[model samples]
Target: MTSDKAHNLWHQTCAEQIAAPVLSGDVTVDLVVIGGGYTGCSAALHAAQLGASVCLLEADEIGHGGSGRNVGLANAGLWLPPAEIRKHLGDGPGDRLVNLLSDAPRLVFDLIARHGIACEAVQNGTLHCAHSPSGLKDLQVRHTQLKTSGAPVMLLDADEAAARTGSAAFHGALFDPRAGTIQPLGYVRGLARAAMQAQALVHQHSPVLRLSHGAGMWQVETSAGSVRAKSLIQATNAYHRNLSSTAPEYVPVHYFQCATDPLPEELRATILPEGEGCWDTGLIMTSFRMDQMGRLIIGAMGDLDHLASSIHRAWVRRKLIELYPELQDVPLRQGWHGRIAMTSDHIPKITAIGPNAYAAHGYSGRGIGPGTVFGKGMAEALLSGNDISLPMPAIEAHHERMTGARQMFFETGATLTHLIKARF
Candidate 1:
């Protein structure tokens, strides 16, 4: 389904709107990016700025995927904490990645300012809230690890967190002063606009029909036209279409969000007073943030388009009451869901799919900052003919076992949790 029909708050409220002509006729460029999400658009923009001819093709409009339907938290680092990342990727590479991503928010906000992106960029920071005592301990460990890495994070006590969040539901919170929120759809569309301004050819509604690499060049074909490029970057992430053989393998996890009408001034003064985005430390994670219009957006892990949609929606209503009893009667105005490409290890992958083509995916719900960083790094690496600049080494291929079953397990778990956990 197209983003317009999804009832997404981002689509309705996005300030940055753009349109590009569909791909027609043959075109050749130095780089051809498939997918017009954050990574693809950023790659095209940076490549074109560096004087490389670039063309980006998207099946739908720009930001039509997870980029448009994001939680809008431009957070640092991956879903995995620093210590777990070290356990997975070794100390050297893990530290490198952690350091790179710790500054990712700066990169995101800087790009927004530099390109004059109309995304509602906010850098007030974010709260990793504690849903329970155990969750508080988890934040303690994260706080220690972050401090060890020289990060400027503050651990807020329950009272402090309650004052900051305007809700007494949290046990504690780990505040990362570096992160923030944005209008996600606006940001991605702004990236596409900036890329176009930099002389990159971006085509919407141009779904890639076939992908083949031969004669040391990558050839991408759509319904009406084709592009042959010296290098390629596939940034389709969760909403991949048409090219299964080249698609990144991951378990598909669904996330849905519900937004209330812009809260009245008195209510707005209490919720998220500092405007920091928030997500609780629950297995079936829940996120909270506010838009420029003062609408409170709440999200959790569950598909709203499936048979269990009623349960999920019911849970959202109950959850709003559970968090803020004052909003017990506030009706939800918008609801939408999006897919996440979750890898088993919770690490993103950059796969060397062909001679000079790489496919990046598996953000696991941490999209904005990492997507921008990886996209620019991929563009630089492709242009310079050196992989040294990449955040992680490109693997030849990646595969996940029991993807379908795993996806179902996630959905089932979320459904069960929402069904029984948040009742007031």
Candidate 2:
């Protein structure tokens, strides 16, 4: 999660600090945004730039949620393949969303450069390594669909993938040169700072206790103050509090990461030297990347603070050793976990809750890119009163059943996998 603790690595080196105060006294604005993750910040930035009076409120510091804790791969598209997206959505909307997300990395990187965000932006690309032959087959299907849609993705054989990844543990890889990684927390904070600079008011430590719509304005009440605005956006995603019973619901998934201390000289040259981040095609995915300081950051799905913590940690140690025996002694000293909002279709949702009020959630694991893009779309749609301009049509409701049981089931499966893998 975007953390309450300043001990997080991204926070330590962050370029932007939270300078906004809590919502003080009553204020009126054109737009009021809740949850200071990617979407909220982006929306605030865009709306303010468009000359709208905007105020953004956060429960904690900006990006102190999944936006700060994500793997930071500015990937293209949703977890579902393009064909599957068409099956879920009709052709026009599906194709539009696919095309928009295809350029998500471009948008994210552009913002970084445009804003001079101090986050380490590595655009060398990412590798989807095949975990097995079946995984390779899945890549093949994905590759065909991507190629058919004019994407410049390339598939690498075992030898090529191994040479690039420095790990001979996969059948092949699908390489997307368009995508890359970032220090997520820093990036999100930078966005908030930029939004503030553009005249958007931001408040931290301003959790909204109650939200109501009445008298031609949406009102959010906080301990410090209340905000009344013509438009409101709920960008909380997975870290959502019970702000409204009518808010969209999604399955909450947990992902955790541990980073080794900066590698010694000899080891730094051996792993991911090409600067490409990677994730495998397993049932439970694993991601590996090198930070600007050469710390080998690896992550998997499971909360590090929960009952499965030990099993997950042990498995991480063994998995690192299995991937690269050269750094067996290096310690993974830092561990953190964050939540994900997962929709049933693995696609993001734009919900129209009431007049001039909207909520977006469920990017699954692809939040950075989608969240940024979705926020921009939300701003444009709300400001212009044009729902048809959105990438995906805004629906009245988005429903996901049994989120709690589903979350438990996913955690249990991850725990069992880690235990068996560590022992075997």
Candidate 3:
């Protein structure tokens, strides 16, 4: 059921966007990365560029996970604000990550340019729309932090927000010139292609069933074959197949998106006229963006593929109309969901599971930039045999995984809220 839901909508739309071939036969390498999403591909690209023999394995095609289904926002930072991050990770490590990713959009766009990646890369900017007065207050705080950190950002009044987003649902907005959008699937595929061109071996349809550490190397066993590498990186993030005991502990949060049939040119001209990706400032956050073909895609908190599919569908319809009253008749052509491996703290982590072996995941819905940044950092760390390869200092391990009633409590609460919202 989960797999079906993953492939039914936007996933189907992205079928031909990736580059080729699944892993077969056995080969050895300096590094073996499991999971070929943004992180794995980036790790391969960076590792190989640094003169390391690299092999990346993907269970499905490249971009089969959240990397493809993403809303395409190349945001600069994580979900946490600078102050909150500093509070949690201390001024040193938190500020380091902040500094690294503050320039992440530049790195992303630069890579796209250098590779001539065909992803529809747009760098105009991104808007964080305020859903309420409280939301605006939060943005104001963020605005201050961003400015203090020398980010190119601007605060927009409600009128300006409405002009930019073509909606009055937001009270205000904070615009970050450093952020942008892309054809997400294309970007991941392009990364894989570039890595391959750089002599990194990437194979799809290769699922690692087990990982064992011995003989001064990590052995990854797959149905088709096996690989032995000096180091291993678990880049599976959310779509992991639970193939090993070293799986990262995380809360599985689901985010779904529905895409409208291409709007008429007139409607497209009004909605996201500046061609910026926009997301809201609510606890249950929402995102909206127009694709190159003018499909107005809107996404929110709950998984559309869950048992509450009807409720999620209803909310999509109503939310569309509420956001753009004039588009009341816009037909939603596709709907899909992907799991986000969210840590209790909503940050990505690098965990040293064993000697010379590590696992990385828990992006908490902020992937693209962080994924690339972290992947490259992981590669450098492995190559250099030092912990300093990461932008943020690596944590030995995250807090104990949320379990039992706690997990169900979150799922039930989210489902209940989604149902309630749809009903009203």
Residues 1-424 of candidate 3 have per-residue lDDT tens digits of 2334444344544433545566667888999999888889899999999999999999987888999777889999988888888888899998998888888889889989998888888998999999999999999999999888888899999999999999988999999988999888878888998999999988898888888889898888888888989998889888888575777778877777888888999998889899999999977778999887889988887765567667777877888888899998888877777778888777788888777767788889889999998889989998999978777776677764545455566556666666666333
Highest lDDT: which candidate?
1
Candidate 3, lDDT over the whole model = 0.83
Backbone-clash count (model 2): 2
lDDT of 2 by residue, 313-362 (tens): 89999988878878789988777778998888888999988899888999
Report backbone clashes per prediction: 0, 2, 1
Ranking by TM-score: 1, 2, 3
Residue 219 of model 2 has an lDDT of 87
Maximum-TM-score candidate: 1
Q: Kindly report which residue stretches of model 3 are placed more than 4 angstroms away from their true locations once superposed.
A: 1-20, 404-407, 422-424
